[model samples]
Target: MIDHRRPVGPRTLAARAKAAVTLSASLRAAVSAGEVRRVVCLAPDPHARFAAVELGADFFVDTVLANGYGLCSYVFGWNPARQTVNAPAVDQFLGGYGDLVLRPDLATLAPLEPGVWQVVCDVEWPDGRPVPEAPRTALRERLADAEQLGLVPSVGIEQEATFTGADGAPLVPAGLDYSVAGLTPLRALLGDVHAAVDGLGLGAESARGEVHPGQYEIVLRHRDAVAACDDAMLLQAAVRRAAAARGVRAGYLAAEASGMGSSCHVHLSLSDPEGVPLTAGATPGEPSALFGHFIAGILRAAPDLTGIWAPTWNSYVRLRTAPFSPRSLRWGRDDRTAAVRLAGSGRSLRLEARFAGADAHPHLVVAALVGAGIAGVRERLPLPDEARVVGELARTPWEALTLLDSKPARAVLGDPVIDHQLAMLGEELTAGLDTVTAWQRARGDLRA
Candidate 1:
């Protein structure tokens, strides 16, 4: 529920009329039908404010910084400002201020892919430049690659997270109860989430108690790749809001315990340009070499991109002994232990990446995966005869961060976003170090 007290309306009716004329009939109907609205717009970042104004959105909420990480692109109210001028079949994008997208205009909406805002940076991009390295850009590039190969990625994300006790109790208690019956509190909290998903038309399949106490998982049906990613982010926001209403903390990291780990398993399939199932093995020779390259590319890039998949200090906790936490970069036929696992053979064949953690930004993760895969396919990269599954995991968060901080990986991800991510990680580590430890007090080791 956004507060629409103030909106970013154009200065004059003529201006509004001019903008409306650019929209296609379907888009026009959507706006007239109340599908799109002039809502409150806020801009904390001056640069973003300038861009929003140029984009012609009528609301701006000021934030403390120039950019709200990804928020600038998340609140523009569905559809690329440019695309609305012509396309009728595509709806307006919709989502929170953080995960907005261009949505389709339809009377009936699906639970998983609801009509929402398509949040995009107002910054212009050249036709030839690689989609700006942001999550959306990356996904677009990857999606394009899939198209070139006559494949479309239809995906669903199964997400697991936790809601804590009202008193700020640790996210996971000592007990190890995983049964649905034992998770009464979780159910009570998620009831609103169920309603919200339904109301928003997000085709959410089910939300259930996980194998861990206090942990829960929501499964959503497969949809377009971008929609699937948007749904994942929206689902998290829904859960967070619902939990807050219930006075519970929603923790997305892995288990607080030293041993147990959490998972963000992505299930994906590919289709042909005409929307026919390409996974049916009816395609041409060499069994879609592009698919093989995509898998290989993801495996190749896994080492550098791991940070994006598991992007928090706490996420490293799930690196080992956790179900679906791959010990190595091997691809297998339905094998959970491999980093990249193949499910269903030929055409109906798809890849599932279990390496991602719940803490990751869904768009970023999928885009990065797609980029790596596209890079592999475009280059015709060779794959090993077998999936290179291994048994070791990053020793600690520090170790993983160190690996990510190295020159090789840094070169691959380039500047700005990579640097930004590293800075965030450093901030987290500093905060962790600054905290006083009970052990220090117990040992009388507090020194001035």
Candidate 2:
């Protein structure tokens, strides 16, 4: 349901100048050629403002306005090679202040780079990392790994995200009929999403309503992993922007509220130099050894991969057997209850990982999946029995993650990468807990 009413047409050089003239004349000239109205600046974090200022961004708003109008875009960045860290021991300092400390000082803001830049509307994450480890980066790394194996991995991303009401509330309790106009806000966002996807060359597939109310899904055609992930991120951002324009918020938080959940589904494939599907074996309908190895690797590493799929505590709530949710790590032929399912057994035999929630970092999830596959092939690890019953699968995400964090899993995943991912996830879990304002503190028990 892409919103048909976008910012009308593209903004003219003069209109863009009018928007920029208040802040800086130079920025007005830099974007004189009818650029899209996607980027915006914010105050409070003057550091963010200063970096944007340096990057020639002229439009400025506060964090509140940015969140409300969804205008925040782009993060001022500092490359590790080019910029010096402001704090030598920033990690240690942050670790002491919160349950899981983030590396804020690791972010160095200097100037914008030349590569394709999206209007991320404030490039910093909640913890202030300049270059965040997003799904985009994770997919890029996995593609690199695939190249080393003489295989190039390409993928298409189909994301399911929810939307909030005008008053910022869940619309699920009302009813879920994908065709309802109540979802006009989310629908409106899809138009901008389409524009974003087309610009990025990710090959837009389709945008439509889902079974759940206020829940929408966008599917894009397969391309290079990095390009696909980049398009996905922009789609996510654009959805938020479009929803904002309609006085609604596009929710990406796997579980945005109590029960509504979002998902990130990936369609992956590996090809040879000639662009023929390498995983597509000798017989058209028969599964290739590569496909088996990859699927087996993912299954073997499911427990450890929990951190990539269910990154947040709340995300686990959506994993148990319920409406459109998976509860176990079993793989089956088109079984939605299993964490991984083999859809096509032929040359197109590919496993769909159902565990990843919208909140899961795309980069980490893809990397873990691909890495596990490579490990399986390299080590000749035996594939486990296909899961026949959901009851046999782990009940909680932690159960799987704990298994993944075991000595054997760590050995296969490499200690350093596992440690870093776990540490980062631990930090996110800590941050999720710090939202104390959502609850009530009763000083005394109510004895009526």
Which candidate ranks first by lDDT, i.e. highest?
A: 1
Off by over 4 Å in 1: 1-133, 145-151, 169-178, 279-288, 345-347, 385-387, 390-394, 402-416, 437-448
Residue 85 deviation, candidate 2, in Å? 16
lDDT of 2 by residue, 239-341 (tens): 5665676676777766765566678776666666445675656775444677767777777676656666776666776665335666555667676666676
Superposed by TM-score, candidate 2 places the C-alpha of residue 382 at a distance from the truth, in angstroms, of 4.2
The most accurate candidate by TM-score is 1
- Score residue 319 of candidate 1 by CA lDDT: 74
Error of 1 at 356 (Å): 1.1
TM-score to native of every candidate shown:
0.68, 0.66
Which 10-residue window in model 1 sums to the lowest lDDT? 2-11
lDDT of the structure predicted as candidate 2: 0.51
